[model samples]
Target chain A: DVKVTQSSRYLVKRTGEKVFLECVQDMDHENMFWYRQDPGLGLRLIYFSYDVKMKEKGDIPEGYSVSREKKERFSLILESASTNQTSMYLCASTTAPTGRNTIYFGEGSWLTVV
Target chain B: AQSVTQPDIHITVSEGASLELRCNYSYGATPYLFWYVQSPGQGLQLLLKYFSGDTLVQGIKGFEAEFKRSQSSFNLRKPSVHWSDAAEYFCAVGEAGGGNKLTFGTGTQLKVEL
Candidate 1:
């Protein structure tokens, strides 16, 4: 079974504070993604990395950045945490590069930005 | 542009009752459809997926989904609902070669009554 692990399960941060949400996958999948889930809004993509050091913006990428220094790790960075940034963050990974593949998700990290 | 719509926001069913969840999508190319379930505070898990071939696909946990090209819909169904089946169900669609970028629906929160 593939496992995707997030570093933090819950967090609280003040306004304008920087925050980091780390995720790691054991499947060695080539694609990694970051998403934030809010009530009634569902899950919206924040950023995705298809390869190491390569990142792309998703539907909701404002105030968020991502890094993929290694194949197993993808980190989501909140430049300046705000109350609006409080959400349940999820990380996912897939093996397909050209064709479609099933994505596996981490447990998720809960953020509370004040 | 690819998009997914789940008409139902919340659904409640008694244990042992039948279950069905509606999902619709808009995609240009051959659509890859998927149904995912997320427990409270947890990441989403793949319930089933439909890429091609058989319209009806079986997934984990006695869940199945059928794909209808004419209607552009993929609906999930279960023979009988259980208490553990209470969770948020999301419908998603992916492009043919879009790096597995998936567009998810707002999700339907299912509540099972014992």
Candidate 2:
């Protein structure tokens, strides 16, 4: 079975602080994604990496950046954490260009900015 | 641009009762539809997906979804609800062309009563 693991299950940060959320996948999928889920807002994509060092902005990319230095790891960076930035962050991975391929996700990181 | 919509914000069902969750999409060409479930503080998991061929797709945990092209809808259903079935369900539509980006719905929260 494919498994995606996140670095932190829960985190707390003060305002203006920087935060990092990490994700790793054992399946070696080519595509990885970062998303923030909010009530009534669904899962909005923040960033995605298709290959190592290649990144693309999703619908909601403001105040967030991503790193993909290796094929198995993807990291989400919050430039400046704010109270509004508190959310449940999810990481997902899948094979490229295949519509039939299903995306697998990590357990998610719950961030609380105070 | 492709988008998805899940009409119900929350639904409650007694154990052993039938379940159905609605999803609608707006896309130009044939759309790839998917249903995902997320437990509290967890990432999304693929329940089922519809790419082509058969309209009805079966997923894990006794869940199934049917794609209706004429209505542009993909609704998820379960024969009987269980206590463990309580979770947030999301519907997504995949972009057809080059990249593998998925647009998701707001999600529906399911509450199963024992």
Candidate 3:
């Protein structure tokens, strides 16, 4: 079975602070994604990495950045955390660009900005 | 651009009752469809996916979905509902070719009553 692990399950940060969310996958998938899950908005992609150090902006990438220094790890960075950024963040990974490939998600990191 | 729509924002069902969640998609051609479930404080889990062939596809937790080309819909169904089945369900659509990005719906919140 594939396993995806998140660095933190819960986090709280003050406004204007920087935050980092880390994710690691044991499956060695080639594609990694970062998304924020919000009520009424569902899951909106923030960023995605197809390979090491290669990143692409998703639909909503305004206040977030991502890092993929290695194949098994992906990190989401918030330049300046704000109350609006408080939400559940999810990390997912997939093997490759296959039609049948399914993305497996980590447990998720809940962030609270005050 | 491809998009997905989940009509029901919230649904209430009694235990052992039938369940159905409506999902509609807007895409140019035959698109890849998927259904995911997210329990409270948990990440999204893929229930099932439909690439091609067999309109009706069985998924985990006794869930199933049907792809209708004419209606451009991929609706999820479950014969009997359980209290543990209460969660948020999301419908997503992706392009047929490789390197396709997934577009998710707003999601439907299911509430199982006693």
Query: What interface RMSD does each of the candidate structures achieve?
Result: 2.0, 1.6, 1.5
Clashing pairs in 1: none
TM-score of each: 0.97, 0.97, 0.97
Assess each prediction's global lDDT (C-alpha) against the native. Answer: 0.91, 0.92, 0.93
**Which residue window of length 10 is worst by lDDT in model 1 chain B?**
B94-103
Name the docking class for model 2.
Answer: medium
User: Between the candidate structures 1 and 2, which one is better when assessed by TM-score?
Assistant: 1
Put down candidate 2 lDDT per residue, A20-102, tens digits, no spaces: 99999999899999989899999999999999999999999999999999999999999899899999999999999635579
Q: Write the per-residue lDDT of candidate 1 for residues B1-114, one digit (tens) a residue.
A: 889999999999999999999999998878889999999888899998888899999999999999988999999999999999999999999887655588899999999999
Candidate 3 Cα deviation (angstroms), residue B84: 1.3
Worst 10 residues of 3 chain B by lDDT: B94-103
Q: Candidate 2 — which residues are off by over 4 angstroms?
A: none
Residue pairs that clash (backbone atoms under 3 angstroms), model 3: none
Instruction: Kindly report the root-mean-square deviation of model 1 from the true structure over all alpha carbons.
Output: 1.1
- Residue A58 shift from truth in candidate 3, angstroms: 0.2
Error of 3 at A1 (Å): 1.1
Tell me which of candidates 1 and 3 scores higher on lDDT: 3
Mind sharing the TM-score for model 1?
0.97
